[model samples]
Target: MILDTMKRRRSVRRYTGEAIPGDVTEEILKAGLLAPSSRNLKPCYFYVVNDRQLLAQLAAAKKAGGAFLKDASMAIVVCADETKADTWTEDCSIALTYMDLAAAERGIGSCWVQIHLRKDADGNDAEANVRRILHLGDTMRIAGILSLGMTDAYPAPHEESETDRIIRL
Candidate 1:
């Protein structure tokens, strides 16, 4: 059943405007915090954004594109303090995956968005924008963002087979 739940999980882009319940959101965050980290170093911090105005500002500043933040009911900003661990990125990623499965179990849809540390060739600095908006310290880094809401469209099933990607040496 756990595998089935994971199988059902997908990157949902379209969402109903209704907000996710506070308790459910809390549960999802708890699940994320419970995820295992390298050498038990938990460097992740979560910023749960439910305010529409703030969300709009974040969407614009972060350049999420395609009205994702505008339509999603809530966003979870996952950040890491680099001083806390060398593997903060990998740790945060695992936590995000846990949150995704937990949300799926509760019928809430979610999508993960990666944040970059430096501006791209066109001069886009999504991480800097996020840090400025969230008032993060210099030591903190934006790891990723999770958009959550009730889905208006069901995601298609995953097509790739993992059998060929794994090897037991």
Candidate 2:
């Protein structure tokens, strides 16, 4: 079930350095593309990066918390065209979430690294740095990056917990 998959989903940083088969990668990308968008204006874009050099560059896209991407087998840079949708952030986020869950279901580990509104180590805009590395257009606003691969560690599923946040009126 989807909920079971969600429970099993965890942010895995360390990868096994094993290459994910092309079919599995394609399936994960398809899940992102299948994500629903506001008003059906699919503005999100997914950039798959498998090159070791580019992954290392992307790992340094932000100031911290992204170095693990360098060891990932592949990464999907999620972006959206702000000119096409005002809800670009939300749209891209859903796409990333879908992809993450899909990866987990297929036994692939993944981590979401936020990029929008983030700063690089040198204080330059993280999004700009990513754009330079990926050659994306100005209109393409990055939401985040998803580092995917096989992992030696898979944490246990999350336990159920009561929450005060949910209320039915």
Candidate 3:
């Protein structure tokens, strides 16, 4: 069943502009929180944004590949307290991935918008811009944003042949 969900999962950018139900959204967020972290520190934090104006601002957080976020019904900004965990990046990534998968499993479309180590349209640090926009403290290091919504755009699933390299150790 998990594999089936994985096969169904794809990076969805277009949405039908239909809002996800409160319960479904909560389920997705809960899945993210269930992700594992190194030393069980659980440093990752999830910021849910549904405000259209805020979503538009976040859409510009990166120089490219994030414009679609403006149309998403909602977005979950994944970040972590760098001071709390050296593995913040990996932890946050796992959380975001879980959330993405959960959305797909629930018939919702999702897209991962990378922010860490990225630059904004004005060439400023994308992470910094997001932190400022969300009023997050300097210690919060953003991993990415997960844009979610209802959509009819169902891309094909990943084929085994798509794996370019898989060396047996």
Candidate 4:
């Protein structure tokens, strides 16, 4: 079942403008919280945003990407506190994957918007702009943003051949 969900999951960039239910959003967040982390150091924090204005700003935050976020019913900004773990990036990455899978399982379409190391239109850092908008202090480092909404279309299934990178003993 987990494999099935993973196979069906894809980056969904378009939505039908259907509003996601509160309980469903809560479940997705819960899944992120339950993700395994390095040395049990759970440093992930999700900041859920539904404000249209904020979403629009987020869409523009990256000049070349995230324009789709303006149409997302909700966007979850995954961040981590550096003080909480040395492997904060790894921890938040796991949480993001878990949340994506959870959303796919629920039939909600989602896409990831990468923020780290990206730049905005004015040559400002993407993470800094997002932090400013969210009122997050310097301690919090953003991992990515997950844009969510009802499925306008299901993406094509994954082909199995990409296992080329796997190494097993």
Candidate 5:
């Protein structure tokens, strides 16, 4: 059933601009919070943003992507506390993935925008800019951003891939 949900998920860019109910949003955040982390150090912290101005700033945080974030009903800004875990990136990534799959299961659309090690159009660090806008401390590093809303478009599910990458022992 999880694979079926994964199969049906798409990187939905377009959104219907409908607000996800507070309860549903909480459920999605819970999914992220429930993710397993290295050494049981749950390093992930999510900032559920729904402000229009902040969304626009995030949309432009990265030069090549995130344009759809402005229309997203809410964007979950996923960050990690490095001091909490040496493997913060890997830990936070799993949490973000769980949130994405959970959104799809509820018929909500979502997209993940990579921010770490990226730059904005003006050449400043993307992660730093987002931190400034959100007032996050230097100790907190971003894993990614997840835009969530009602679906405006549903891209087709991916076709089965050729079995060339698997290496069985």
Candidate 6:
């Protein structure tokens, strides 16, 4: 059953624009928080963005192929404080994976959005944009984002990985 849920989890790029229920959102976040972290530091933090206007702005800033954020009901910006956990990126990634699987299990669709938090070549602070958009404090750093909504298209089945990719010592 769990494997089925994992297999069904896909990077949904299109959404139906129907807002996810608040209770379901809470459960997804709880699942993310329950993920294991290095030394149990659990330093990941989440910023839930449900504002349509804000989502649009984020979509515009995204350089990736997917435009789902523009029409999705919400986006969860996962962050971490490096001082609390040096392996914050890895921890946040695991949490996001858990959230994705949990969303699929509940019939919700989600896609991961990678973000760069450092200053750009023009000296523009990337973190400043995220902080202003999410009303986050200076201590927090953006790790990644997750666009959430109802699916408008079903994902194709994944192909099997090659056995040669795995090696036993």
C-alpha TM-scores of all predictions: 0.88, 0.96, 0.97, 0.94, 0.96, 0.87
lDDT of 4 by residue, 44-115 (tens): 899999999999989888767799999999999999999999898888888999999999999999988998
Clashing pairs in 6: none
Per-prediction CA RMSD (Å): 2.2, 1.0, 1.0, 1.4, 1.1, 2.4
lDDT of each candidate versus the true structure: 0.82, 0.94, 0.94, 0.91, 0.91, 0.81
Query: Positional deviation of 14 in candidate 3, in angstroms?
Result: 0.3
lDDT of 6 at 126: 55
TM-score order of candidates, top first: 3, 2, 5, 4, 1, 6
- Candidate scoring better on TM-score of 4 and 6: 4
lDDT (tens digit, per residue) of candidate 1 on 36-120: 9999989999999988887776666544452587678988888899999989889989888899889888889888877755443
Best model number under TM-score: 3
Summing lDDT over every window of 10 consecutive residues in candidate 2, give the lowest-scoring window: 157-166
What is candidate 6's lDDT per residue for 11-67, written digit by digit as tens? Answer: 887878877888999999999999999999999998888888998877755445435
Per-residue accuracy of model 2 over 4-23 as CA lDDT, tens digit each: 89889999998889889899
Which residue ranges in model 3 land beyond 4 Å of their true spot?
none
Candidate 6 regions exceeding 4 Å error are: 117-126
Model 4 ranges with Cα > 4 A deviation: 166-169
Better of 1 and 2 by lDDT: 2
Tell me how far candidate 2 lies from the true structure as C-alpha RMSD in angstroms. 1.0
